[model samples]
Target: MLRWTVSSTDSFLIGYNDLDNEDNWVEADGTQHSYSRWRSSEPNGGVLENAVMMYARDADDWIDVNVESSRQFICKADIGASAIPQPTVNPSCSNGWESNGGSCYYFSSDQKTYSQAQTQCKSMDSDLITIDSEAEWNYTLGYIRYRYYTRDYWVGLTDIGVEGTWVWENGGKEPTGTYHWLAGAPDNSGGSEHCARLDRYNGYQDASCDGAIYYICEDDLYISDAPRSIQTTIQSTTSAVITWTTPLQMDSQNADLIGYKFYYWIRNKQSETTQSVTISSPDTFELVFDSLSPGTTYEFYMTGYNSYGEGVASDPPGNFTTVSAQLRSENYALNIYRIAKGVYLQSHVIFSTEAITLQHCTNICTGVLSCQSVNFHHKATTRAKTCEINEGTRESYSSDVVSDSDYIYAGL
Candidate 1:
């Protein structure tokens, strides 16, 4: 939510202007001021989810506000808003790039080859644009719409010169963050033009730079680097699993998560520290550090990353208890059985000692958290024989479940 304050300045623009500590300021043009008086709710400009709005702070329930509503808002106190510091904005101010408050941007039109269009943008003193955040993207969208281009234009990004090697004309190349591919498109058709274009989708696709496509210009925020998040788990005292989610609003929408790195430390029986563990991946993850010294403690957390940057690591989530394992939380019952190494739970056996069946085995495994694979012992002929439980072979599928009518085993 946007926070507004009546500035000490006596000018009529008083409350509309917002000042940054570095002296950079974003003045709210009468948009909010006029709307606040008549609109039922505060306005919201967030790109993804719509912001919640209420007429008054003391209101019991909040309501959805229009993008144009005006309301005295509260900013998140803990995170606080980041100020965009003033910098040498794109100097070719007169070029196609639009400068709203201070930054500059180039709108695009699909036309010309990649090299040729870049040369054109350079003539304007700006290279192709690199968008990093949703704010920048929102600004670009409006800026592009404001341009008088008849069609989409090529921007600074493309993979035409080298197949599969996408790079910016302004810098060393590689794609960052997750991407949306145009539907059945960007085949680099005919292999003649490798230029790219940015369309309404906020997605990019290769096109003939000279194709007269519309473009976007940019004056960037000097964000040094986004924080990185790292996660680790330890099956220590009580087999604690610690997961830390970062505080940054990264690709929270489409998720640009590269993977999580985990760190864990355990103590030996002598009270000495064990080797720390590190793990990484580009997907949801789970790690268990088993065989911990009972009654010991462990610490761990998770961090996220993409090509653009990594988010801050969450604070350590820790667990203590080396031996006591609690099962059956959330109303789920758990069953742990001692099994023979190499023998799988090929099938399920009834308490009455009936033959094993596939339906029963899968159900049993699904009910238990520790179980990953399941097998039913269907071949056993003895209805009185009790099924055997054993460790499953790691690399191969489960073989036949042991079943023999001759063996009359007793059930517990």
Candidate 2:
């Protein structure tokens, strides 16, 4: 197996063609070295293969290879007198809270339901812990293993809003990278396991939200400022455009502003099926939502995210309603205004019959009292041309209507 050495790049060389010069050798950290362990004819690739690697098969002698090539790499760490320094509790943290990576964590001894645990965290001005990165996850797992080895703890991960789509309490989706779920876990057994818990034996498993379990809470030191100047515009009957400005105090935080997360939900709906979209570019301040239901009002908000996690959502969420459908005309003579090319109404078929032409199909639909829409299909043979009359209109069944090259949908 090839392994990387503490040397790379040929930009420091006095001349590009000087392969035998030891003066050109410099560590990745810019420390000059005169050490010579090169194999015969090594370093001949010069400009192209600038990185040096130790050849394990050839007496561990060094060889030059392309810096971009993937290989096992060795790292060196500096050790001091106090190799592992004792952790000091943060002064700002409350009693019994431990600090790591600029965040304070509290591991509860009392078992509570997921809701109760979140309430307790809210009382302390914190939320259930969200493991944002691999370092945080490792630290949390290690701390739990050492301090609370026999117990399962609840974190702020759940899919209660949208089943099978786990989200952190901070409103970020479960990251695509570095998630730790045991094999065949999160089965959502009995269809009631909407919450996630950290198992002592395994990684993560879905559990009933009502089941009592210990929990962890976190208080971050560097919370990001929320976005401002949120605005929404109704673009059409089924779409809208939302815009917002970047947070005013973004540079005050130590982390970079990576992106923004947009949220929307129907207004006055009991279930409140909220959905979120993550824009991974900090420069993007606007987004268009096209899959909205007509005549429905929706609330919108946005939050900025970074390496730490999601910040607070913008205040005073914008609300907008899509344009409502016009009332059907009482006179069927004006039905030509409802005809749409390359569209087909799905289901609710009142009757299917052969028609001589597209005009004949419309006339047949006009004669049927129950027909609100008609789908006319074109065929090579005149006798094979067909018409399907439906009781539903495109405005009434917007989701069911689809585009098709062979059919024309006309509403009466």
lDDT of 1 at 188: 69
Candidate 2 wrong stretches, greater than 4 Å:
1-85, 175-179, 224-412
> What's the lDDT for all of these models?
0.42, 0.72
Candidate 2 colliding pairs: none
lDDT of 2: 0.72
The list of candidate 1 runs beyond 4 A from truth reads 1-96, 100-102, 108-112, 145-150, 172-179, 217-412
- Angstrom error of the Cα, residue 226, model 1: value is 14
Ten contiguous residues with the weakest lDDT in model 1? 16-25
| Model 1 Cα RMSD, 1 decimal | 19.7
lDDT of 1: 0.42
Question: Model 2, 37-138: lDDT tens per residue?
Answer: 677887776334556776444553676654444566665567654355666877878899998887888999899999999999877777898887888888
